[model samples]
Target: MNKKFDILAIGAHPDDVELGCGGTLAKLISEGKTCAILDLTRGELGTRGTDQTRKEEATDAAKILGIAERENLGLKDGFLVNSEEYQLEIVRMIRKYRPEIVLANAIDDRHPDHAKAAKLVSDSCFLAGLRKIETSMDGINQEVWRPKQIFHYIQWKNIVPEFVIDISEYLDVKLKACAAYKTQFYDPDSKEPVTPIATKDFFESLTYRAQDLGRLSGVAYAEGFTSEKLVAMKNFDGIVL
Candidate 1:
């Protein structure tokens, strides 16, 4: 697609974007912002689902979130490394999308891949802006483009947030999108191997965590993000009381 996006959310695995920022994404799309999701890997190493299953679930979740586009980089799961090769691949996507903001994996999380992907995406966002660092797509040289801001969505850890977006009305949308990953979540009927996220408690944490953040922020529900740079607002009027 040739259309520029307002935001691009990149995740290490298929469900990362959905669990971390689905509510914010739904809210953004409802407000008419163009958004896309890029999965760094298909989550092949996960206990419960096959790569193909995750891919299908991701597609369904993308549709539920009203994403403009979704693409996978085919990176190796569990063995994710912040290498130049991976960074270049991400740089290519950054130049292609030309997003104003980038939502990436948490800086550090319970999953090792999460931290690695965080660095990979953050570095690629910088490298993508350097005209000398060349990349091409579809046999055409891509333009050098950089996002104005990069934010890290909270994942498995209860890390403090730099900011929280009010997603009171969009929380249901987020939960439903996450539920699309039936094979990966708390599906009691599935005879698949149990994992940390396959438990009922894990499913409940998705809602309670958002609720706790909302309680702290005085919103009914919200998604939290951490940024490398300070977030500045044009005026205090935009701040939720």
Candidate 2:
């Protein structure tokens, strides 16, 4: 996967991206743009499933999304920290993929790791551009690289978005990708331990939230994001009617 990516979505856990911005990703891929996902952790601490189970689920989700690549860093779950070690690990991926846009975890969320991972990725994207800060992978030196934009997807919180992507057509595809994580989401028959996300209500919120965002933004369904820097549209032609 040496080819540069159009977008790279980073998450605190295996299923975070699926829950957050899967619709936008699906829409982008359908438009012929290349995308990738980087899970900062294997979601090892989730009550409903094992790390291995989550990994398999992540694979299924990635396949459903039709992303170019899905990689996990195997970082400690539930204990994410904004430190040099973590930042450098993410820096390597940023330089390796050289994506144009980066979608990251929410700036603030119900889980502390979400916010921490958000900051870690934000800083790494900046550090990856520093020519002096050296990093090597597979015994080869990596060239400095940085994404043109960083956007944090809305998670458990409704954090007012800087913008929204009209994903009305791809909402079904996103739901399908999320359903791939069987053990993590709503399942009436399975006897998995009830986690905050495993509830039926949580499953339904996925649709309502997107619908609400779309309603406010004059679309049928949409995914909202907060941009670190102002995004400029080349012209009025890009605006949704």
Candidate 3:
């Protein structure tokens, strides 16, 4: 599909987006803005789930978030690097989707791949705008496109947010979306070995974290984001008091 998206969220692993900005995405989609997700890896190396299970879970999460489309780059899990080849692949998706805004992985996180994917996606966003950087899809040359803004979502770390999106109405949707990754999350009866994210505490932390961000922002629930460049607002009217 050649349809343009209002925003595109890219993550190093399948559940990263869901953990990071699923609430914001659900809020945006509910407001009629189209969004898509691009997963850099299938989370093949995740402790609790296989690649096939993650893929299925991702699809299910996308539906919950009302994503227009979801794609996996099939990049190696846990081995992401900011290489030209990998950057070009990301560039192609940027050009193809032509999104005005791009949501990306946290700059630094517990997982090294998260930081690596952040740099990879950020570089690709810049390179995608250069006319000389040629890229093609489906035997057709893609047009040069660059997102106007790139916002990194909070993940793992309690990095201070540049801004927060009120997601009180969509928090339930976000939780449901996250729950799609059954194997990756807390499963009381599972035989899989426990991982960092597979504990009951991690599952409950999702709600509490959002609630904490909301408390700081004076909202019932919220999601946080950090921008590489200063954010500009048209006016003070949109600011939530």
lDDT of each: 0.94, 0.94, 0.94
Q: Per-residue lDDT tens digits of candidate 2, residues 1-241?
A: 3359999999999989999999999999999999999999989989998999999999999999999899999999999998999999999999889999999999999999999999999999999999999998888899999899999999999899999999999999999999999999999998878888989999999999999999999999999999998889889997888
lDDT comparing candidate 1 with the true structure: 0.94
lDDT of 1 by residue, 1-241 (tens): 3458999999999999999999999999999999999999989988988999999999999999999999999999999998999999999999888999999999989999999999999999999999999889888888899999999999999999989999999999999999999999998798988888999999899999999999999999989999989888888996899
TM-score of model number 2: 0.98
The digit string of per-residue lDDT tens for model 3 on 165-227 reads 999999999999999999999999999999989999998998999999999999899999999
Off by over 4 Å in 2: none
Q: Estimate the TM-score for candidate 3.
A: 0.98
Worst ten in a row by lDDT for model 3:
1-10
Backbone clash tally for model 3?
0
